[model samples]
Each structure stands twice: as structure tokens, then as C-alpha cells.
Target: MHRAPRKKRRWPKILGFTLLGVVILGILAVVFSVQLNNGLRSATGKDTPVDTAVKSQLVRGIEAKKTGDASHDALIDKAAETLQQTPMKTITEAAGNQQKAAELVSQTTGVPEASAQVVTQAIFNDSKFDGVRKAMANGDWVQVYQQGKTLSSDPDIQALTRLVQ
Candidate 1:
């Protein structure tokens, strides 16, 4: 006698593929969430621990304006910025380069060149900074962070600040 033809089950294969697709979508969702959260954290306009760092160095510039290091101040600034600028040695060809520091302040803060002299006077070892004085000079000064931006408007300076930071 001829054997009867049997039906193939399609349910198992279909269920397996569906489960795989769900898992893949789930992973993508998680990765996207993490990226979005990080970007938002920095712009919360409040301290959200976007970056917690500790920097130590002798602060010059102004004697009376003396305060804590840049790393700690960054968290306190409430603008999601680390007021501390990158060291001259790390970003410039010269180790104790004064010009680079001046540029960052001038471009970032729009301060008169005459006022930025204090920027060159401070000494740092790799990572260091106290307050705005880290980038200050002479009698008194101001702030700028756009590209150097504690408050930045120039695209060129903004791009430059991003590169350095």
C-alpha cells in the first residue's frame, strides 16, 4: 500500500523568526535611549552630573577671586560646562605656551587683549585650574565659553572649543 502524504508544520519556524525580530528591535531601542539621555543630560541647565572630574593646580590671575578647581566648578556652574579650559601644553606645541591660552580667552570671552594677560601668568601641570582666573589676566576680566563657551556665539570659536574640549 502507498504511504499517506504528511503535512509540514509551519508554526515553529514562524514563531522563531518573530521572536528574533523582537529581540533585535529591543536592543536598538536601548541603545537609542542611552544616547539621547546623555545628550540631554549636558543641557539640562542644571547639574546632572554630566561629568564629574577633579582637577588641582595653583590659581593665579586674581588673588581675591580665588575659588575651587575647574572640574568641581564645572558641576556647579549650572550651565553644564566645565569652566576649566584645556591646558596650553596638551593643546599647543609649546608646554608653557601663553598665546594659546590668550586666544581661548579672547575668542571665548570677547575680553580686551590687555585684560587677558593674567591668562599667561598661571602655571599648570597637565590638568589644573581654579576659577575663571585660570583664564584671566591683569586687573580684572570676564567670561566666554561658546566654542570656549560658558557663553559662545562665534561658530569658529565654538568649533575650536569643541576640538579642544
Candidate 2:
């Protein structure tokens, strides 16, 4: 008489291990996607901690200048320099591409492209505020008057103008 073949019990173990592997892979993918999003935000300089700190420092320096604190002039200058060195080059460079520039400006400044373009023009227009430039270079009162004339309407620029004043 032929003996009955013993049935293998490996299917349960294989299925369990396969399910565990799939769950682990799914978790890893989720983690990786989250990290990627964070990195993209950081790279774009959107609401970054460093940007917030720099903006605060700039505001404080401007306020100090308004208070006639001569000691803070150096601080104001340093803060201005820091802001100028920030990674806004992309926004600035997009000027040649109207649509792209507008979109970038809107995203960065939270303003419509039309308004953002005006602000950008004011900020980048060196010839329009010759007096302000001179005043900034020489630390003269002309900076106060010229900056008020040139950028008084823009709160952000007004704050920056205080650095020169």
C-alpha cells in the first residue's frame, strides 16, 4: 500500500513574512515622501526659520535707527547686508520672464503679481533713488527724506529705509 504524502505547512509562514515586508515598505515610502516635501519647502525658502530670524533682526535694527540710536547703525547695516545676501536671487532673476517673475513674486511676498512687480521694481530701481543711495553710502539725512519719498507706501520697504535713516 502507498503511503499518503505529508502536506507542507510553509504557506502560512511565507504569507506572514510577505505581508510584513509590504507594510514596512509602505511605512518607509510615507516617511520618505514627508521628508522630501520638507526639503522642498526649505530649499524654496518658504517660511524658513532663518528667514524669520533675519526679518526680525532687520525690523529691530530699523526700529533702533528710528530711535536715533547711533550704536545700532552697524547692526542695521549688517542686517541689510544679510538680507541682500539671502536666496532671493531666483525671484530677482525671474524679472525677464513676466509670468514666471509674477508667480514667484506672488508666492514669495504673498501679493498679486501686479503689486509684487511694483514693489520689486521699487526695490531694484537704483536710479530712481539716487539720493537714498548717496545717503545710505554717506550716512546722511538725505536717506530719510529720499527713502520716505521713494518707499513710504510700502511697509516692508519703509522698514528697510529706516536702516538708512
Candidate 3:
């Protein structure tokens, strides 16, 4: 006797379930991403126009320094002026977040995080460079040299001193 042919297994159910799982995973991924972005924004606080401008200027300064371009000193001076114009509280907060900022800069510029941190801290926190900023604004090389002499021993300040001069 001839055996009856077996019915082919239907794959629509398996295909449907797989599609559903993929869609669910995609939705979850989107939701997770949105939540993460919101959390970071809340943690970092609101970014103002000045904050944007300052960050852009700081990045430009970093790029200039990395390239050793002729625009290096001008870019750094512009960043300092922008920082000086920003509120003290904002400046303090930026300095406090230097590590995070460095990570971001590293990601964007492909610079090492340690080097980015050095630049960020020197730009935002190192009080030794305040005189340099002032001297830059005043076009006073004498004051820049005086302040540089005092801070020459500090590696961070030395880096900033090199940038300024």
C-alpha cells in the first residue's frame, strides 16, 4: 500500500512570532534610548546658548592646540573670553563635569580622554591660568609671563602657559 504524503509544516506562525519579537525588541530599544537621553539631560541641567557657544569654542581651542596651528592662541583666548562671559555657577559646574566633558571630547575628536581631561581642567578649573586670561584680554605679555613663571612648575599650568604663549 502507498503511504499518504505527509502535510508540509506551516511556517507562518513561527515567522509571525519572530517578526513580533523583533518589533518588540526594537520598541524597547527606542524607549531605553529615549530614557537614557532624558536622564543625561536632567543630570547635566539645561544647556543655554552661552553654554553651547562656550563648548564650541572650547572644542575649537582643543583642535587648534592638537594641530599646533597658527590659530591656537586666538582660539584659546576666545574660549577663555566665552568662559569669562558665562555665569560663575555654570563655569563651576562645567569644571566639575570635566571628566564627562573629556569623555565627550574624546569621543568626538578622537583624542585620548586623559589629554582631553587635561585640556578641559586647564580651561575650566585651573585658577593659575586666570591671570593668563586677564593678561590675554589686556594684551599684557608682562602679566602673562609673571603668572606663567609662578605656575610653571605645574604640568597643567605649563601646558596652558605654552598655549597662551
Candidate 4:
């Protein structure tokens, strides 16, 4: 007697499963790469960590202000006020902090005297400016990070981002 006909396996099911596996693996790889990239960025003074650090500091300052930490709060307020003042006054003060870097950013970014003054003043207000200034002078990653942090915390940066977009 002839053997019963062997069942013909459906090619579609096999292909579908293989395609599904490939898609899943692709997604997983992308996620892993993103995570690895983030880790590397944090270690190398990249923008992400700088932005996060600045944002955290800003939030802490707000909390301090809310809790009535008068000195710290006042410092923040004074910095904000300075930025709103005339550009020459602001730039003059910033030049005392990091003359070269401040000058570079102002020139390279093509910021107007007024806006550059405010921006540089906001940068100098951050207590970390000394380290940042050194890094800026050397054109190091640290300076890039510090600049990113400064820009992230500055209200002017957000405003500029909005304007450019």
C-alpha cells in the first residue's frame, strides 16, 4: 500500500516567523545601541549628560527657592536680572570671567552685542564657570559639556531654540 501523502509544509508560516524574528531583533539592536550610545555620551562629556545636569541643577535651584533658601535664591534672581540689563554691562562682567571663550561663542554664534552680553552673563552666573572657562580655553570636551549645561539652563537658550526652529 502506498504511504499516506506526506503533509506539505506551508512556506508562508515559516517565512512569516523568520520575518518576525528579524524585525524583533532589529528593534532590540536599535534599543541596545541607543543605550550604549547614551552611556558613552555620559562618559565623554557629551550633550545629553550636560543638559541633564543643567536641568537637574535648575530644578534644585527652584526647589531651594521654594524652600526659602534666601542666599541661593537671591543669586539666581540677580543673575536673571543681570541678563535683562544692558549688553555692555553684562559683557563687561562676563569678560572678567572667561574673556576668550565668551568672545569666541559671541563671535562664532553671531550673537548680537545685546544677546551675547545676556548669554555670556548667564553663563558666568553658573558656579562651575572656572572649570568651564579652562576647558573652553583648551577647546576640550569638558568645555563643550559645560557650555551645553550653561545653554540648557539658560532661558535665553530655550527662547533661541524656539526662534530658530
- Pairs that collide in candidate 1 are 118-136, 118-137, 119-136, 145-148, 145-149, 145-150, 145-151, 146-149, 146-152, 147-158
The segments of candidate 2 whose C-alpha lies over 4 angstroms from its true place after superposition are 1-5, 35-103, 106-165
The digit string of per-residue lDDT tens for model 4 on 94-158 reads 44565543664566456666676677776677665555554433324444466768766878767
| lDDT, each prediction | 0.42, 0.55, 0.58, 0.55
For model 1, residues 1-165, the per-residue Cα lDDT tens digits are 998888899999999999999999999866564344334543563322322121122122222232477764553452223234443222222223566666655665567766665644553331333223343321012221111234245565468556854
Per-model TM-score versus the true fold: 0.24, 0.25, 0.26, 0.26
- Measured on C-alpha atoms, candidate 2 has an lDDT of 0.55
Q: Write the number of the candidate with greater lDDT, choosing between 1 and 4.
A: 4
lDDT of 3 at 68: 53
**For residues 50-145, what per-residue lDDT tens digits would candidate 3 score against the true structure?**
345545655665555544555766665655555445443343333346665576556545678889888778665757667665553333334545
In angstroms, the error of model 3 at 90 is 10
Give the winner by lDDT: 3
- The TM-score, computed over Cα atoms with residue i paired to residue i, of candidate 2 is 0.25
Instruction: Name the candidate, 2 or 4, with the larger TM-score value.
Output: 4
Ordered list by lDDT, greatest first: 3, 2, 4, 1
Candidate 2 C-alpha lDDT tens digits along 1-165: 998999999999999999999999989866564344335545785634433454565566555554446666665665555455545334323543445655666775467778977865764464545455444323233343556466667677677766756
